[model samples]
Target chain A: MSEFDLIGRYFAALGPERSDVVLGVGDDCALLEIPAGQTLAVSIDTLASGVHFFADCDPEHIGHKSLAVGLSDLAAMGAEPAWATLALTLPESDENWIRAFATGFGRLASAHGMRLVGGDTTRGPLSVAVQVHGLVPTGAAIRRSGARPGEAIFVSGTLGDAGLALRRKLAGEPVAPELWHRLECPEPRVALGRHLRGIASAMIDLSDGLAGDLGHILAASAVGAELELERLPLTSWVAEVVAATDDWSLPLASGDDYELCFCVPPAHIPVVERLSETLGLTLTQVGWIRSDAGLDVRRPDGGQLRMPARGYDHFPAANDGAD
Target chain B: MSEFDLIGRYFAALGPERSDVVLGVGDDCALLEIPAGQTLAVSIDTLASGVHFFADCDPEHIGHKSLAVGLSDLAAMGAEPAWATLALTLPESDENWIRAFATGFGRLASAHGMRLVGGDTTRGPLSVAVQVHGLVPTGAAIRRSGARPGEAIFVSGTLGDAGLALRRKLAGEPVAPELWHRLECPEPRVALGRHLRGIASAMIDLSDGLAGDLGHILAASAVGAELELERLPLTSWVAEVVAATDDWSLPLASGDDYELCFCVPPAHIPVVERLSETLGLTLTQVGWIRSDAGLDVRRPDGGQLRMPARGYDHFPAANDGAD
Candidate 1:
């Protein structure tokens, strides 16, 4: 079968049932009927080999991670995903690789109720881009600039697992199978985002490490913060993984953790805990939004914590002195 | 400067008014507020070096053509383009190349009232993918499956100019500058599409040649058609250019013509003419939908105009055994 035919079979299965999706994947252009009271949320992300992912990574993991990254955007906005479009470029047409990648992508998409509406598949070096669309009620969506000086910063789930997993993979260590899965398929906090929609003031997904991603909220809102290093909700597994390594800094600064880091007024922390219980999601308070213009760090001994400040920069480290 | 910084300087200038774009290019996700009574029409296209374009073509042309191809999709759906997301892959960052490309792309996008809402730029072999979204009234979309057997087939503007331009460029022929511009910067029929919203029964953009693109409408509607050679509206320039060639076959079979090809019921002919007058877009009657299972072409002498039945196929072309 031709590439179009192959996509027709598998790609159309990614859309979730929505009133606006009048026509789904089988056309020249996808037709959508935006309902009366909703705004569309759109995000596009592309992962390229040697920059975003390893050249020799499994194709299935690559497919899964691409979808997760796009979904992470919807999570940031507290929007319910409606549809997704995929553009896949491959070095060459290999039937086995395409099949595995499609299957992996389909599994994750189905799990999240995302429909594949339309896309283009072409010949090129391996890269995948997913453009995701979601619907949020008008005037109700969270944004990065909504945080206030008195707000408390919170993050869903633990960080550093993905970063540590990448470290293990890069070092050719005999990492646990779970570590590989965490590195390959980090979950975007979709359900948590939906549940926290009305409560969170500012929200963003942690793709560029906690420090950098949090910095976005600060920069956008014109505020800064102080985070207690001991209060960071690192999983025991992450602690163990880092304890085995001489340098665990990358786990704190490297990226690919598809978790939600958000802020809420201190008065809403009770409501946040209540929503977390209702959704069965963990909400950890890590820092406080401050009126100051720079980031500060605190340690468990009540002393100031000093560490190198660095995160994922799109350019090489020489330009920013990141390494 | 890195790719992101480059986007910040040049490409970001095409953004819409802040009020119009609820969320703009710098966010993790961009949000668009669809007015109370609008539907979204979306299409995606990928252009890869040595596949969709020549390896040494001007980067400016490539960028312009990429946006034009996606805009053509909106034309097919009879929707007003409002936003576009660009995904660009580069082997290395070239400041001059990106600046020239952005200049061409931004000019075209602004002309069509499309905002560069968001996109991703990455390091890889050169590739460009664009996803465009347009708005239409509720329940007023023109789709490829809506044509009936007796509908009239029409094409906007001329066909095969881009293909001929490519041929001339390949042969290093000195063609008129206008023809080269047509090849590089073909316009998408946005206003014509909006005028045709309720009149066109089935529609598709002519990117994959007339025969192949018409095949999409036929396959979707479960009908077929015949074309009258004498009625084909080949431009005078194309006729002059191809007069010495073996045939004017590429005019009907070669791809990359961004004009809109659509079907309308015979009764809507007056409406189409009025639309053409109002929008200043040509509406030429090229053929008619048929009940037959396959396509047929009639010659001027009432003989068979036996053109080769082919379109842009990705796989290697097997010898047809005609010899």
Candidate 2:
């Protein structure tokens, strides 16, 4: 069958039905109605085989990660999920692979109330490009430049399991099943982001590690930060691994965590603590924004510890990942 | 430099400024404000290195064509272009190539009053995926299912030059300069499309040849069509080539013309004729919609001609490019 026909049969019906979608699949363009007094949030991400995932990884996992990455961006902006479009390139037409991928994609899409509107399929090396569209109240989006000096820095969920899992898998070492799952399907904190829309002063999603991503907020806000190393949240698996190996860098500088790192005024700590308990999720206070102009990692004894300036660089040779 | 640094230096400044864009580059997500009473129109298209164009083709042309394809879908929907996001994947970082590409992309974006909101850059086999968003009046979008019997069929501009140019280039034959230009930089009829918003009964853009694309409209409308072979608008170059080769199929079955094929009530023909004169474009009366359930091409001598059922399929071995 033709690529177009294959898409219509396997992927068209995957999109959830919605009233706001005036036009969906089978049209040149999809029409969406954005309510008055709302702003549309847009982000795009592309994941390539071998570079973004193992070539032999499950197609379902690939699909989940592809959409999750884009949604994570929406979450960081405190936007409610709405619609998405996928541009998929495949090496060949494989029916089984397509079916499994669509299942994974549809499951997450339906859960978040996002609908697939339009996309194109082409022939090439395997890669998935997803563009997500969401809506937020006008002027209510959490921005990277809104943090101020004396604000407390916060991070949602645990960190470093995905990077650790990747390292162990690459080195031919067996990893715990929980760590493996973390690597395969990281959760995006969409609900927490929505709840924090007016409370958090600044926010970002940690796809490229906590240190590097926080550095973006600092640079954009023109402030500095001092992170408490002992307070950095880690999963049991990551903590055990770090204690045995005497390496604290993975949780601090690893990539692909997909958690939200945000900032709030110091006076709002009590409210945030209550929110963390209510959600049954760990919201760790790891640092504080400062008036100075550089980042510092502080030890329990109040001394500074030497660390790398940044995180995983896609172009490792240039060490350019540091902001 | 890292992928992020390369993007910051090259593409971060490519987007033009607009008031509706609440946020642009360097954010987790870009924020856009859709005006009240307007619907957002979305479309996506991807171009692979070898599948869509020559692997070593000019980066400038690739950039222009990539955005143009997505813009064409918006044009077919009769939406006014507003914003676009690009997800670019490259085999390696080449500063010169990146500069040329941004120049081409930014030029077209400025002309159409569209802003580049946000996107991701990744390392992989070369591909360019663009998602375009536009605004249209709610409930007034032109759709493929609106055609009725006895309506006059209209096509904007000439067709088949891109496909003909592709064939010549593949065969290593000398092609006319105008034909080569048409293949590389076909224009999207955005202005004409906006003008035909309420006038056209059904509308679609010609991407995969007239025969195959029109079939989409026929299937959606549950109708058939009959075309006059001699009435098709062809450029001087295409006409000369057809006369010498006796090949009418090029204009009928070739793809990538990027022209509009629309249907209008017979009574509205005079208004459209005036529109064509005012716009300085040739809007030819190519055919008419019918109540029957099959497509037909009539010769000048009033005889039916046999033609292929569809046009170029991506998969030639399976003849899947044909509709």
Candidate 3:
């Protein structure tokens, strides 16, 4: 396959078009419009073949997951996604792989009204880098440092299913179809994140699991959290396994959930709960913020569950439970 | 070195803080302000090691050239660059190499008043993908489709110095410091491009030499071009070599020139010429747009110069004269 064939997805057959994009592709640059009183939110992520996923995994899943991780960041910022540019590196130009990748990326982008503007496809080891641009009304973006000491910590949707699937796959065990789906197509919580601007004090997407991602909010806000072990929103499979083994790694240390972990002030709890009900999402109140700067996990018997004191690191140990 | 150390260029040690960036690194996304009445120009490019550059090339030059290519795209649109995001993949982290790379990248970014807003770092074969965002007044961006049949074609600076350096290095010949610098740190034509907004009918950066890059302008404008073989701006070394060997590949088909090739209407030619003089740049008038849809190279004796018909390709054979 020629480079032109792979790049055709942008100039001829990409998804969606926005009024804001004056020049979409095939230009030196894509010209975009940002309305007055709005801030542009930009997020970039790279998914390496062996580091992030198995090289033999479906290219469609690689496309979906690569874009989803960045969209999850936009969602955490309470921004509306508008455009994305991709930098794809491939060892060889595989026509079928490019088609399947475009299929996955275009479908998700069209669902959110996001447009693929411009990109460069080069020759190299397989890797995908996606940068997404979003819009939010100025002063309304949710930041990690806005969580007050007395705010309530909340999470939307079930967690750990993707992590469980990854663990199973790495262990050479057969994963259930539903669990595998969660790993391959973790949806970005865009709808809920857009609605969280006024209600949530601080927000972050759970890309690196609860313990590491939530720790960012705590450190940034100069507050702590006390989480209830039983209050976490978990799938039946993860919950049963954790309860039987007395292990919390599935829900706490594992990553790739793509769910939203947020902090809402006590005063806005009722409002956010109502909004979650309207959106038909399970809004679990798992914890509360504290004045002291530490995280405490309370067990059902009222004893503290101890874990390591760590946030995010650039490179982590292989078996640290984060893929 | 840990991933944290490699990614710290954005969070702590990168240069130049711009007022337009509201929230930079250490957050879910970078929040930026794009003033109304302006359009945002975006361009993304990836430089894969062993393909774009030798695997053992100086890491500092790799950083400089990677960002420079993306900046060249923004310059072609006559936009003022504001921010950039990088997604870097590396097989391993080398602290000294990273520091030198940051120094090279930071110096250029600070020169343009562009900020490093956010990015991702991961483990993989070495590759650097930089996406630059710029601002231009609404409807003022220079597009390749704007050129007319009667427009005069011009280019900034000399061409083929980088291509000569590459050819020499590959053939195990001595390369002068001046020519090697051309390959290592080719400057983007930002200064010349910014001043040609209204004066130029169409513009593009000569990253892929005249034959290929000019073909883009011709194809986009649906016009042909008549280029004068004697009028090409060539350095002393390249001129001597071409005169002795009768080889036109270096000046016509090689890539990585990083100069501006633009079209100006007959009436605006003098205006752009005077502006180039004021800017202290050598602006050479090498060609003119024609009504017919094919490229013609006229020799000094009035005969047509015959060469292959080709534009840019994602991947080409090793000896295509493009680096």
Clashing pairs in model 1? A14-A114, A14-A115, A14-A116, A15-A115, A15-A116
Best by lDDT: 2
Looking at model 1, residue B209 earns an lDDT score of: 79
Report, for all candidates in order, the number of backbone clashes. 5, 1, 0
Q: Candidate 1, which segments miss by more than 4 Å at Cα?
A: A15-19, A240-248, A299-310, B172-175, B240-242, B305-310, B315-323
Candidate 1 per-residue C-alpha lDDT over B79-132 given as tens digits, one digit per residue, 9 for 90 to 100: 888999988887777888888788778878888888988888877788888899
Candidate 1 residue-wise lDDT, A28-60, digit = tens: 678886666777889888898887888888888
Candidate 1 - CAPRI tier?
medium
CAPRI quality of model 2:
medium
Candidate 3 lDDT tens digits, A1-323: 45754586433546687888899878899999999999999999998888778899898888889889889999999999999999999888777888888888888888888899998888888999999999999999999999888789999999889889988999999999999988888899999999998889999999877987888898889988899988988899899889899888788877788899999988898988898889999889999999988888998778897555343444654234333
Looking at model 3, the pairs that clash are none
The top-ranked prediction according to DockQ is: 2
Per-residue lDDT tens digits for candidate 2, residues A1-323, read 66767778877866579889898889999999998889999999998999889998899988888999989999999999999999999988887898889888888888899998888898889999999999999989999999999999999988898999999999999988889878888888898889898899999999988888888898899999999978989888888877887666678888889999999998888888988998888999999999987789886568896444465566666774342
User: Over the stretch B1-323, how does candidate 3's per-residue lDDT look in tens digits?
Assistant: 45654575433546588788899888999999998788999999999888778888898898889889988998999999889998888776667777777778888888888888898888778899999999999999999888899889999999889989988999999999999999989899887878888888899998777987888888889999999989999999899989998877788878789999999999987888798779888999998999988889987778897544454565664334332
Q: For candidate 1, report its TM-score.
A: 0.93
Considering summed lDDT, which 10 consecutive residues are worst modelled in model 1 chain A? Answer: A314-323
Candidate 2, residue B275: how far the Cα is off, in Å: 1.7
Greater DockQ among 1 and 3 belongs to 3
